[model samples]
Target: MSVRQLLYLAPIAAVLLASSSVVNGQDGVAEELVVLTDLAGLGRDENSVTYFKASNAGAYERFGESIALSADGTTLAVGAIFEDSSATGVGGDQADFSAPNAGAVYIFTRTGSNWSQQAYIKASNTGASDRFGLSVALSHDGDTLAVGALGEDSAATGINGDQHDNSIDNAGAAYIFTRENRTWSQQAYIKASNTGRIEEGDQFGYDVVLNGNGDTLAVSAISEDSAATGVGGEQDDDSAAEIGAVYVYSRDGADWSQQAYLKPRSFSTEMLIGGILFGFAIGMDESGNTLAISGFNEETNRGSIYVFERAGSDWFEQARLVASNPEIGDGLGSAIAVSADGNTIAAGAFDEDSALVGIVPSDQGIDDQRTDDAIGAAYVFVRRGDTWSQQAFIKPTNTQVNQHFGWTLALSLDGDTLAVGAHFENGGSTGINGDQRDTSAQDAGAAYVYSRSGTTWTPRAYVKASNTFARAEFGSSLALNDDGTVLAVGAPREADGAAGINGNQAADSAAESGAVYIY
Candidate 1:
């Protein structure tokens, strides 16, 4: 298949959100949130800017498919999974098109409101179809990065192994890089340690995350199958059939090693279908002491998330979370985000149907009416000692069917602010708090921001693209800075072919070329 066709086969993931509005605690007041379309020559207090493919046009690069932000909001990482550059490493010729779909990551640094491209990174052993930037994560200090290449076919099993050995198709691998004095070097190459044999569809690095100190790392091999129940248990058994697994690795000095292997308490029977039960989302605290993994197709597509807590060097499952009113096809864990402390979690059920507004009653029975099908809902949970309980159920104020709200989600470090992306929302409203009554822009997408004061959560702002157009998918992915002061929204299907900062967003110029907006 062609690179563009293969790109469509990859699963869609969720994102984090940042905001320009602030909510005052008294009388539910919200301050005006500034929205900027172009980031050219903007100051620190400016609203936002849009970025697109800088070096090439009409390549179907998908520039904003995945994004990550440094804790301080001074650095940003954007991934273009379909980028066809053959660049080998940092600062290489970005115009090289010798390789197709090898992928690339762009690093931007901010100094007093000015943002400049710092690095262009790719896999050390770049090859056609590697898709190196399929997913990207950065350390809190912005010195370390983990890049996932889900289409990589290497069969090597450990760190820094031979990536040239492409014997297993789509077995997948992740590369680690560390920065010293602003220069980056390949630190490690990681893959599943206990897959037993090279499996064609294992996708070991579909999602990667690093702790604040950059010492502990987590990678989800959503396609990993073994009868393994917990840490170090029967990984050779293929009978489990795509049961899915998460691997934890710890860093001591400059060396990395696998610490534990985690799997769901009950193997998902949907494994027979192959792709649905993959570990779709993952979240961890800054200390790496707590971890949450979401399986979007678990339990007959009701979806579930497993929470684990670290005890010394070993990790143990602490709780299993599901929607209070579980219904088939709700997609409960399609998107998830955790607070910096890991005590609070927000999971999205994009297909959840409930006409009722904010904070649904906890014990309400499931309704089969499907009146609000695909309007979507997000659930919030807070940890108290060893127990986690549902704290809230969130929905948009103007709920519309098929909006697919909560297709992506992000939470502030302190868990006080939340952002939910409804990529299919039809409202033509532009910027923050515009009219939702206008249905002229179909699938134009919108994002919602919520703030929590104590235990009460209130809707704060509604966000949309400045050039709202049908099928833009504006809220497809999101990334938020630690304090939620900065947000990046991706509209991979955006037609404007403008490159770099604030170029002309001409109509139908760059179909599916993609664009990213920072706020």
Candidate 2:
């Protein structure tokens, strides 16, 4: 049996939804949670995946806001969006908290079963409130990395533009870094071609996705207001308010350039108040030939996803997808996952107000009623050739108001294993296979794992916090290893000030200090 040794500083409790026929001969049809530690690796246990403390973790650091694991699962990246350090490049003075909300990313590598922090990264400009590490992505080999700063204020547009200029307000930018011989350096600094200026608040790099090979990337500008549709459309058009747009780029010989600008054909007049998007629905396939971009129709209050395909040097829209049974305010595509081959997609509607429980038939549609408020739902879609169809409607076995079950999603390589996070879930369940019906804790959060055999889906595991405390919301962000054998969950609101294993779980000194767990 494999052992799972972890250094968990965050206190948390909660259980999320998952369904399926019993597999692996375990209770709840889920694999048992195993923990083991090596004598040599103590502070950061050998059996533990790396334990990240940001070298100088403090309250409101917001570490674990974003996380990514290399395809091989040897490397991990964690983002602390509220990190306050003026350090530039990597491994600089982390003790300097001169820049508030400047943000930072930590890189950790595993040798055998032991893990260690290797680098502390920050934006080149390192301006205050830039939020450089709010979003992050890693290449399959873990050599290429992308960091997003939605709060960056540079007016420059396109690749390698001027970095010193900060006339623009919250235009945002994305930085690419490559590793060679265990050394890292910035490759390029990217901004939207239609970069927003002062008062625009485009937030260009709100989300970033890198293809496995690290040659292609997709960046989302959450508040872009262009009414233009299709690739290479007019960039100056601001007729639409908060009309979102995505920028695609490719790398050749260390140089990067914009490939295409993407927007769904079913456009939105404006992004609504609940339109705050996470890294959920925006992604690229293994080769970056296929992509999924999501947006909400303000008029209909319904979210939709745009799937695109690349041909030679151009990109073409493949399909626009929505929930099988669409309902106003379902919040479909709030978070989404695409298979490595881009043939399978799981879209989460966190605000979906469904009263249903467990898995529903795929051929038929959902009940489409506002039976529960913010109960949440997720849909699975399969592609046969160029056509796509919904395969299953999933819900948690135990549902509660404002559980927000589909807040985040991760799909394993080859698309068989799937994990979902309900960070708002209130269940007070602890550890693996525990009772999920207990709802005493508020915002304790939970993670659920499911496996697929042929076309049938079944529950694989139920994961909860080891400390089982409220407000930790353990699964706020998730990353799965290539084959899905390893899972990493992040919680950005842990109050424990202590670091490392067996920390002071009762310490409430640090509020909003984050932590990550490997299972």
Candidate 3:
């Protein structure tokens, strides 16, 4: 019998079919031994990378400080929290450097593996040091966008209130933008409903989240300092400092109204000082009926996640989740994601000090493990009727201290896939599943992907920046498409200053220029 070779290629990765082996980085360097067989479809190409930066990129802009992806992954929004552009609204002047740390958001659209800049966005009333892009969110279809300016000084209250008022200092504000066809226009300028009575330093837009339909929004004010608890509580009381709060808003036609104001209950308030973050992370299901808000209790140095469900026009707390064997400083709720159905939730304890390795069974909270300090861990929980329970515990195959494995995470629409980021990982490896043992590149960053089959979760891929560099923070932020087939990884500290995709990535010319990677 004659010997023969069989060949196969993923339909989505057909462009790379010419090359049997996968290459890493845009430098045209084959830094890995990975081949197409290992990839095997799902529209994933570990070897592929599309790099992006601000069109008017300057050093320390932190172009990828925040990021969001449309459900299909064709549209992307990148926030340059330190971007200096003083431009107001969409498609304004990006060259002027009058406004320092003003922040800006850049939108991009992809077609057949090619990405193009769609718009450059700024707050409606641009101001210096506003940090307008500190946080950003996009709707499923990319028709609606929200930008947070945690340093915004306006004391304006309600929707589309006065944006020119600079009376309040750091009261924070959020902006809503809607797209018609390919053009985008500002829809509203939102401030905390208690803006005037709250004084200043609330940081209302510290974090923001938008549902798939683009009609619902949840914004976090990490340092609201309210003694009030529960929804629609007394906002006038600011005695309890740093209590934090989350605001919900709903859109009808083109109008937006505040739906609810949520504050923590029995939360540790004394230690809320020293920059402790409460209600620092927020997540919402596609339908906007489910919400998960994570808060860190500074007193215990531990964290808790609060779940809420919506009924008619009211929102009520469902449960307060804590790690089964949570140790002090676990930081379990730094990052979180809720599935489309609102049944599956993944929470990240980026500060977790677990020394456990590999894919362990569901719920390992009983294990009193610690050696790799700040190695990080993630817990998956599934809801049944009105009950919620942990389903799986995840750690990387190679566990190392200071890895921060679960710093950020995302879930597919169906809740079948998950991606976790470790921006502090010190691996020099490139492409997927490379050498994680190397600690040469400090904080070069890496990402991990996993898939679920029924109740079992399995490791899928180990991802890294094509041009991995020390202190790049490659996984600082992450976003996944509806099907989890596409991913966007932000490396805010990436040194390459070049703008647009496929630019020179090997140079360390632009310090802190930041970059985004598409896979």
Ranking according to TM-score, highest score first:
3, 1, 2
Clashing pairs in 2: 4-34, 4-35, 12-468, 12-469, 13-469, 19-459, 20-458, 20-459, 30-460
Per-prediction count of colliding residue pairs?
Answer: 2, 9, 0
Cα error of candidate 2 at position 129, Å: 1.1
Q: Candidate 2: deviation at residue 303, Å?
A: 0.7
Clashing pairs in 3: none
Task: TM-score for candidate 1, please give it.
Answer: 0.89
The prediction achieving the highest TM-score against the true structure is 3
Q: What is residue 253's positional error in candidate 2, in angstroms?
A: 1.7
Error of 1 at 448 (Å): 1.1
Off by over 4 Å in 1: 1-57, 195-199, 268-278, 357-359, 363-365, 368-372
> Local error of candidate 1 at 341, Å?
1.2
- The candidate maximizing lDDT is 3
TM-score of 2: 0.88
Q: Which stretches of candidate 3 lie over 4 Å from their true place?
A: 1-47, 196-200, 268-276, 362-368
CA shift of 154, model 2, Å: 0.4
Error of 2 at 26 (Å): 20
Report RMSD (Å) for each prediction in the order shown.
Answer: 4.5, 6.4, 9.1
